[model samples]
Target: MSYISRLGSAFSKSSMFASEFFLDLYMYAHYCGISPFQDRRNKTYYKLIIETHAIEKGLSLANPRMLFGRKKITEIMKAARRYGIGSNDLPILMATGALQDYLALHRSAGLSDPLLDSIDAFLKDRATASAVLGSGGLRHYPDGMPSPSPEKAALLTSRFSCRMFSPEPLDAETVKEIVRIAQTAPSQCNRQATKIHFYSNRERIGQLLALQAGSAGFAETVTGLVVVAFDLAAWGGAQQRNQGYVDASLFAMNLMLAAHAMGAASCPLNLAVPHSTERQIKIVGEIPKDQRLVMMIALGRPADGPLKSAASPRRTIDEILTIRDQAVAAA
Candidate 1:
């Protein structure tokens, strides 16, 4: 390539970077929580999401906290009313039913809290609860792996994103073994940039989870937390700008599967945060600034005996996969 042609290419790439930088600035200014220009409807939608998450987490935790659900149930109902309840309200309704079950069980044992009465009264007249509770609600099933089959497909389908974990702490060597398996994940140019920060200390895990509010109730039960990250310094140039995230994510998936295979229940927590929150997490976790975080995985054994989990349905393969050969020919 000619020197002038290379210069022109460089200039074009710089211009593209400038444009993307401005676009990112615009998004950060208007779409994030601190943005004054954020849409009010979006705020309401997020509030509903927060309440829904609290409800789901409360029910899915190994130790059910009726009081925790009690604290958010009213807010959930209010938000549901404001947002115009729909099928999305099903999880909230199901959580409320689970809380009711706990309350009933407590009463049968000659134990009751004042809050339980108010909770019962509120649910008695709740239109949203009446709408979905009986027809479609969360159901608990017996816990055990599928009947022995040598089929690989059966094993793949058996994996679940477990929220509740047993109290026993995971040993460091066991965690290292999982990472050893995850190390086989493909990386760009054999860079092997993926890194994990393991936190087994109860207090440290609590601090990390507090920074990530989504895992509020279940954080206490987590035996360990792993922060998946990749070194951006290993990348060469513009073409490799997003390779870190891609590689780190692949490693994370492998790590989860490996943990599951080793009798560990793992839940991937979102780390897609604003710059400020990301910085705070780095400081608290003592992670190097150059390491870009992909996500956090909560790891531990599932609770012993019968337990419940979210039956989050998946989309059909036809809905997700597409064949573009015909489109290419038409073009």
Candidate 2:
């Protein structure tokens, strides 16, 4: 769904169909609205050809399965975090595949569904910020620069979300470095209720990777993973749902940034396995069955990938910040 200058501008409309099959599909989708001479046979060909190409292309687009299966989902997620589409696409792809969903949603609904949205949500600063945050990226100003010396700016600036990685083992000391950094992350009232388990041994790594893959990475990448746990007893008293996540996430970001500083690339993966799967990982890691699993981290040296994976797309500043009523009053 990319477009160049239209006919009579740069390339002729006729020229597009000759380029790539996707381009051909684009041309046909466009022509469907204009051309009267087009027949059912031509339309059918466009449908069939585009559907075939889209599915194959989608698989190659950013599949983590190419690396290994759930055994390496962290690798897949590192790539996905860099490209947000990977996370969003998986469940959908898992549910309906690429083409079938596209046809039902886009083709049948046609161009209308895409362009029809008001796009107001996309235009909002908060919405844009949330999108970036959810995608594991930090939001920024419009001109592609961060506000001078803001929180998380350094972390976000140094992060590239990684595209590829080596199938190598994480050095024990390297794991220690990451653990040290994460342990320093602030906790509620200095509760310091978090603990980390480093698993690189093939036997243990295999179990953890399995839990991760069934959850959707298709494979676990690299040699080790860091399992972050928060003691339920740490927060004590009544704890809100958001508190658990917030405390964990704050610490998680600290760890990720620290990984980069220590000359390693890391991605935050999930523990989305079934209860049984999670139980297996905890036992293999010998966590004593008392602490709750907060999150997991995959770490290693990054691999070479398409485009270097450094160019991060971001929202405009005006698209991410706004003054609250109290803040505005203070101003």
Candidate 3:
């Protein structure tokens, strides 16, 4: 039996191994800083069975007397061996199953907001990111919940990617702290495969901005640019298959949210600058050649116009959240 199927079977089983195995995988993803749902669309068939089984097992966990036993766990292992481990079902299956207990255990950590904020950045339309610093007040949650803002819904309602920039320049330390905030982004298996490039050169900043803007018309007044990326060497040039890019990207997104929280406007850039700019950056900036540029951010005060930058439109949750016919059985 394949290792994946064994894991799936273990996870899908409505008995002891179900939630416990899920909990293990959840911790692993958390440590790796990967979103459980972020890329599951890439592998859906293997995931379906695990997700369906997890729900059934979760129900059983609630009521031990009915269909909940070691024997059920045995079924899950058997099923997993048959189905495989890297299944798309693993993400949701892990999410909806053991995650509750996992969240319950980590309730004190309050890491959920940053993680949720990162997910929001990926799902929402973003134009750019920034390097602004936050006041001490910004870090404190007025009413501490496992969510963002004084109201739990603040994460959903008020969070947005910042666009536009002022002529002002942020201090190097401020940029350092903003990157420092990103430094906390979880890495896969604690590999910490990420790095940051701080750009203060107005000319270079404008160049990147223009390339991303599709014209020389990018906000010329912008003063800060930060390149978020991952160091391939961190993976030893062999762990490429470990999927570290997703981890770094998610970390960068969280940094963008933290910047917004700190009362600064920013933009996320795709770094499509010409090879010349890339070479200049590599030479002058001393950037590692193997690091993959995950994303870039332009940070500064908002220079107001007709509001050239606003939150782009987003899909309804219903669009992003599909209800598989069987997964909806709980509904």
Candidate 4:
């Protein structure tokens, strides 16, 4: 090619690349939750999730401050009242339960405060009233950790996304074991950013699954829901921005395999929503803001009787494999 022609082509390519980059920035600004364009409902819902999680985290602390998170409880009440969030909503219900647990814990210790009265009033208010759906606040683990199960060779090929599940919930021991196996998945620099939030409450599971798009027909049958996420704090620099997803995906695959090995069925649900929706999920799931969601896994004991699943045909080995041999051919 002529020198002038080459120069012109290079310039055109650079201009196109710059334009595309700016377009990406524009889209991100318009849609990201941090931007002003975020939906009002999502913002209100996100606030509730964050406040409730704060209470939960405080309760989980080994040495919690006396009467801590009073402001957070107030914020939760305000958001719930403003948005009309009811007990039927998992996030609100969890917030109420966490507050109740907080009050009970403090009262038992013979500590009394006006903030407790405020929390009590908030709980009794009809506008924000919600039954504390299931056990919330702090999760109590069994005394000892369960040992990991032996690896089954057939699990890889035999396992598929299970759509139908029995009414039985997954046992806590088995769930812990599955997570123990999944924790073995490789991570970037061994940061171990991946975290799983398991939900076994049928009503809460239904509420969570409702936010997901792919669980339409079989959501009712799902007895366990697992939200797989990776901590953003584990990654730094522009090059590592997307690394969280890669690591979390690896962890999620391992988790599914582990479930299958444990004789439980699991189906992965996609979380390809806007930034606003993601924020809402993080809040509702009681996940930390530093974590980014990868996907959700609906799991449980397989239903009895014959079951059907997608064929999910695969490409041929020849189509997928590409053994480049340019050096050999040149030689």
Candidate 5:
């Protein structure tokens, strides 16, 4: 090849790469929760959740300031009203619970602050919202951590993406147990932002599976659908933008494992759709607008007789691992 031809080809490749990188940035700018071009309703709800969680974190602190988060509480109230957050929304309920605990603690200590009076007034106006005060506040843990289990490897390797299922509907108690196990998945800063929505209705499962598009062959066998999502409000700053997906993915993996442990079959379904299709999914699935969908899970009891799954192999340790010790002793 001539030198000029080679140079021309290199320039063309570099230009194409640059264009693709900029396209990624453009998508991030428009779709991220912090973006101004994003939906206003979602943004407002995200702000409310973020502020509410801030209060929860403050309460959980080892040494929290008595009057800390006064500004945050004010912002929470503003966002709640701006977005018309329902009284029963978990974030609103938790915010009210945190405020109530704050008020009770300060008053019992004989402390005086104008912020307390404002909180008192706010709580009085929304008295109905205080129903969940017991559900959200911090709890005392007299006992320490539980011991680790010995069946880790057996449980992990035995689980697979189950495609065939029995027609029997999964009971409500089993679904709850699976979620309870999955909730133990760790998150950044103990935020616990993952949310699971389970649909046991056959018709609804079919509707959701239609949008997922990956469950075509086995859709008829699916008796339950699980939507795993993470609240975007639990994150802040540009650096933490993608953390929600990471946290939710961890939760989803745990959920699949939990299903397997409980003798229920589960297959992880991908939600790699456009923004418009995601909106449609949220509407059909009745998921909150501020939560980003991580993936869907098709759940059911395993069908009788021999079950079959693809032999999805893993790379050997050497193929997947890299070791750098002291930079090879400066060889």
Candidate 6:
């Protein structure tokens, strides 16, 4: 081609990228951060899940067959109710019902704990409680229940986000091994740009978690924090800007699964704070400005005993799937 033609083509490409970059920035402002109204339904939906998960976190400890943490459980239920009432969400109703049943069943089984009175009081508002706790709340198991089967399926299904970690320090080498396994996660264009900053120091983890906004009861107990970040330098243009988050998230999931496999528990800490919080996190975490934060995974040994995790129900495959093979023929 002629020199003038080549120069014109290059200019066209650069102009297109510049426009795309500004468009993405506009979207980031509106859709990405600290927006109160964005995805309100989903926001409250997960809030319900968080509150319900708090129960599982405590119940799944090594065996005592008795109720514990009355005040904490009551607080979790209260939070769930508040979020549920605000949203009037069906899934939240279902979860609340299941939790009520779980608590009721334990109380009936002579599991001695003072929380029964509180549970009864909460249930006294039968109208509100029954509205959410539809007919089938949850399944109950007598004292000794076996792990869910097909070992791999159990590994996937049984894994829970542990809130409480043992006070004992986690081994650094174990953390390294989990990350090594997680490194196998694929990245767009094989860029493999994900970086993890592991914080084993208690004070530093607390500082980072403070900026994180959540992690109230468990942050101090977290033996380690994995700050997952992806390098912007790995991508070329605006078209690939969001790919950093996508790739880093995949790596983060792998790291969590690897931690579970190695008998270490992990809780994913959301890093979706305001820009000011992000700036603070950058300083506390020592993350470079060029590296975008994905999320933090709180890792450590689970507190010893019968561990109870939230049986966060999964929607059936059909609920989420859409088959469109016939549409191609019509088009």
**Candidate 4: Cα lDDT at 282:** 77
Reference-based lDDT, residue 108, model 3: 42
lDDT of 1 by residue, 113-227 (tens): 7777765665565544356552111235476422324686654566666787889878888999999998989997878999899999899898888887768767778889999
| lDDT of residue 162 for candidate 5 | 65
What lDDT does each candidate get? 0.71, 0.50, 0.51, 0.75, 0.75, 0.71
Global CA lDDT of candidate 3, please?
Answer: 0.51
Q: In order, what is each prediction's RMSD in angstroms?
A: 5.3, 22.8, 21.9, 17.8, 23.6, 6.4
lDDT of 2: 0.50
* Cα lDDT tens digits for candidate 6, 1-331: 9999999988988988999988976787776534674686565556555556555544443342356555556765675566653333545554455457657658667775557766666555545544434322433333222234566667676566776578886798898999999998998889899999999988999899988865765677888998999888898765776888999999999898788778888889999888788878999888999888889999998776544444556655776787966465554
> Which candidate, 1 or 5, would have the higher lDDT against the true structure?
5
TM-score of each: 0.69, 0.50, 0.48, 0.54, 0.55, 0.69
Off by over 4 Å in 2: 1-154, 214-220, 240-244, 304-320, 326-331
In the range 1-331, model 3's lDDT, one tens digit per residue, is 9999998876655454455666767877754324565444433433433443333333322121222223433443334334443232333333223323322323444545443343234212111221221110111123222124677657445544344355677777777677777677778788888787778888787655554552223456568877776777666322243456688788877777666655555666666566666655566556788776666777765543323222122334774788777554554
- Per-residue alpha-carbon lDDT of candidate 5 for residues 3-110, written as tens digits (9 for 90 to 100): 999999888877776776677799999898899899997787567666765565555443446888888888876776565434555556656666777788779879
Could you give me the TM-score of model 5 versus the true structure?
0.55
- Backbone atom clashes (below 3 Å) for every candidate: 0, 20, 21, 0, 0, 12
Q: Judging by TM-score, tell me the better candidate of 2 and 5.
A: 5
Clashing pairs in 4: none
Displacement of residue 144 (Cα, Å) in model 6 is 12
lDDT score of residue 147 within candidate 4: 25
Q: What root-mean-square deviation over C-alphas does model 3 reach? A: 21.9
Candidate 5 vs 6: which has more lDDT: 5
- lDDT by residue for model 2 over 58-173, one digit each (tens)? 23223422212221222322332233332223221221232222233333434443321321222232234334222211222233221224466665575644434567666788
lDDT of 1 at 162: 78
Show where candidate 1 strays beyond 4 Å. 1-13, 24-50, 69-72, 78-141, 144-149, 236-240, 315-331
